[model samples]
Target: MLFSLLQPALIMKISNIEDIPGHNIVEFYGIVQGSTIRAKHFGKDMLAGFKNIVGGELKGYTELLHESREEASKRMIQQATDLGANAVVNVRFSTSSVAQGAAEILAYGTAVKVVPHD
Candidate 1:
């Protein structure tokens, strides 16, 4: 109820193309990007360290990264929509360690308006 009300109704479409397939780019609004950094809690960090030694996927770290990426992507789309873009093209993602126990995620793309090719 409250969660649904707070959620965005529209999520701008994104693609790894200069223009959407089968569509024409009618406008270009330059580049847009969103980034965030996250770190695991001390307990999760210790658990992850043990998992690393055991050579298994660190579930906590994986979920942290996944959530970070989703947040970044949502922010990027919001920025593009604020620029009056209906879509974001040539989307790209990047990740890097911002600190010993923290990682940064970035989502970037060119904001554009597109319509189906006639």
Candidate 2:
């Protein structure tokens, strides 16, 4: 089910779990990771400040984080593919403030080759 959703955009399967259900991990290529740091522009930052006063969702910041996460995930997947991995297991994400207005998003997982059970 999840595989189908990911198939169009990526060849590598990514899962937070250790296993991929019907597939068996035949080989491991160690850890693969990717990260990106993002900061809102002056205009967006100003808007966010105003929104904070009203105590509402920061849509600008939300979109920025979403883009950062996607970029990081794509990079991680590319690294796994380069290592001859068909999937990434035990995937995880981390976020941290790199500066006052900048945040870093990281994606990491164990690269592995998997084969369907016979």
Candidate 3:
């Protein structure tokens, strides 16, 4: 009874579908999370009168933001998995300002486990 053992691990109850593992999901329910990210500005302040018609890439800032969002999403997923959830659905993403100089990204969805019929 692998599924029985993973009962508590399930987070979502799919009240819609009754089959799972092949795109047809069972009636289970869970929560899924997602995040979005944006680049950051560095110590080098933007000059008041300087404007580039084409936006030059900011490597460090871009990397920092992309990595941060990825880490955050992974953490959320891991949290769900640790709880014994096997699948996540209806995931959505969002972003917001965490501070004056930093932003936060979030990913959310339904976490659940599929139970097969006899």
Candidate 4:
């Protein structure tokens, strides 16, 4: 109820971490988002980007990263919501190597309450 009211289900966008709240949002703990990418994928994207310089749309790779990030972010938010958080603030994102062929993407933010302006 609290979270559903604050973070409306309609505008369920998970993009920038800066758009979120802080760490002290609630007592509940949740991990809404999780992302994993492959280096070979990035490399392929880079190659595709290079080809775009002489051809057409270069949006493929960009879209790939964007979608992955969004998925991760959404998951994170969902996790927090599952824990009964109304909002998440002070979010931060980071990418790291998971293995020789893979990389991990993370989207994190604090879940908190946003009082309505009455």
| Global lDDT scores for all candidate models | 0.86, 0.90, 0.57, 0.60
- Name the top lDDT candidate: 2
What does candidate 1 score in Cα RMSD to the true structure? 2.2
Better of 1 and 4 by lDDT: 1
Query: What are the C-alpha RMSDs, in order, of all predicted structures?
Result: 2.2, 4.2, 7.9, 6.5
List, in order, the clash count of every candidate structure. 0, 0, 27, 16
Per-candidate TM-scores read 0.89, 0.91, 0.55, 0.55
Tell me which of candidates 1 and 3 scores higher on lDDT. Answer: 1
| Weakest ten-residue segment in model 3 by summed lDDT | 44-53
Question: Per-residue lDDT for 32 in model 3?
Answer: 54
lDDT of prediction 1:
0.86
Candidate 2 matches the true fold with a TM-score of: 0.91
Candidate 2: C-alpha lDDT: 0.90
| lDDT per residue (tens digit) for residues 29-98 in model 3 | 4565546555465542252113334467655556766787666666556656666666666665667887
Order of quality (lDDT): 2, 1, 4, 3
Ten-residue stretch with the least lDDT total in model 2: 2-11
List pairs with backbone clashes in candidate 1: none
Residue 55, model 1: Cα distance from true site in angstroms: 0.9
* lDDT score of residue 107 within candidate 3: 68
Worst 10 residues of 4 by lDDT: 19-28
